[model samples]
Target: MISSYSEYKSYLEQDRIALGVRNDHFSSKIKDFLFPNYIWRFEQTLRKLEYYYNCKNSFWSKPTYYYLKYKFRKISIKLGFSIPINVFGPGLAIVHYGTIVVNTNARIGKNCRIHACTNIGASGGTSHAPQIGDNVYIAPGAKIYGKINVANNCAIGANAVVNKSFEETGILIAGNPAKKIKEIDIKKIIKHI
Candidate 1:
């Protein structure tokens, strides 16, 4: 959620750093554009549209926001991501571009490194989605749903189905009903966060 220009810039910078983009300049940007890390492009458009929609009410903002929203939808469809705006905080790292579906109601905190085939959604089409904390690592093929609250610095392993909440932080949760496997140093896993 970008409410101001400075906040938008800061969030963009944090997102770049989270994605391991070291430099920001004309040349580097041109290179990235040419090579096209689609995820970066998606995030850039997402931030821009969010900023325009949230902060501005001028005439130009409306058309620009709609156009960017169209572009954002195209990119997301191409990347197989269904993440909605304002759902994720700053420093979100999507590790791959495949089958990452998040509910519109889910609220994930900053510094979340989520892998492909992960679904953070509500159950039975209800609005009871998960509220995940900061610096969490959601591994590939994980399915976390319902009205659960995952603590900060938590790691959800691959293919784990988490339906319940885990209040303890700095723990690794795995297995089909997802339990605390062990306590881990989250920094070791989410290095960018």
Candidate 2:
């Protein structure tokens, strides 16, 4: 949980590092911070920051909390990412901004890169959401639903609807109710990313 200002700063730095912006000099960092695709991630971080600020019992908390919530809501509408503050891990990358959504109960791991039009959400009578793993890549229009567990280093191809668990790591899953397409070596590919 992002319960402090230090935690918020760390998450921002983690996002920058995941995006390969290690240096983060003033101009470059600010440019990339507001870059269209990347802005959703920053907004998500802001939501978490707002959550922490609201937890404090100070006189200043009200104004700050409301301001951050207003900003978060405004940006969320613009970006179309309906995800909550708690679900994503530190190094999330929203590669594109169009129509992406995640259930608040969903838990995504670190360094996951999700593209446009993806949905990580609930399904059927189940009250739970998908649990995605570290360094996973979700392509455009992919849908991961229910209490499914997607293991680390896996990739969900475009338009795949994942409904069940794939506990085995390092494979490609794609289909209507997604199945393992083939074994994949994400470590080699992630080096370039």
Candidate 3:
């Protein structure tokens, strides 16, 4: 939720830091553009759209909001991402440009480093979805669903299918049904965040 410009900027900066990007203005504008990271661009449009949506009374807010919304949709489609606005907190890092579909009702906390081919969605055609905690790392090809709650500083192993709640923090969960593999230091998994 970006209610103000300062908070929006802070969220964007945190997202950049989570993505291991240089925070300098020149680096953000010149370096990122020259390379063209679609994931980063999607995050930027997402943040800007959220900001404009919150502050809708500005003279240029409506047009800017529509433009950002269009751009966001385009990038999301290209990257195969179906993430909704305000679902993820600050410090969101997408690992790759691939299939990463999230349920609209899912609420993920801060510093979530999610890889591609991951799906955080609802089950049984219901709206109930996983509520993930902060500093969580979702590895590639992970499928987490249901109305489960994952604790903070957790790591979901690659290709893991999580269906139950892992309430204990600082642990690694994996497998088809998803079991707690072991207690781990999340910092080792996500060094930048």
Which candidate leads the pack in lDDT? Answer: 1
* lDDT to native, each model: 0.92, 0.77, 0.91
lDDT of 2 at 60: 71
What's model 1's lDDT at 91?
96
Where's the lowest-lDDT run of ten residues in candidate 2? 36-45
By lDDT rank, best first, the candidates go 1, 3, 2
Q: Tell me the tens digit of each residue's lDDT in model 3 across 38-102.
A: 78889989888888888676786677778888888988998999998989999999988899999
Point out the higher-scoring one by TM-score: 1 or 2.
Answer: 1
Q: Which residue pairs collide, candidate 2?
A: none
Clashes of 3: 0
Question: Among these predicted structures, which one has the highest TM-score?
Answer: 1
Model 1 alpha-carbon drift over 4 Å, by segment: 24-27
- How many steric overlaps are in each model, in order? 0, 0, 0
lDDT by residue (tens digit), candidate 1, 1-193: 7899999999999898899975657988788767888998898998888888788889967888889989999999999998888888999888888999999899999999999999999998789999999999999999999999999999999999999999999999999989999999999998985
Positional deviation of residue 62's Cα in model 2 after best superposition, in angstroms:
2.8
Clash pairs detected, candidate 1: none
Candidate 2 Cα deviation (angstroms), residue 132? 1.3
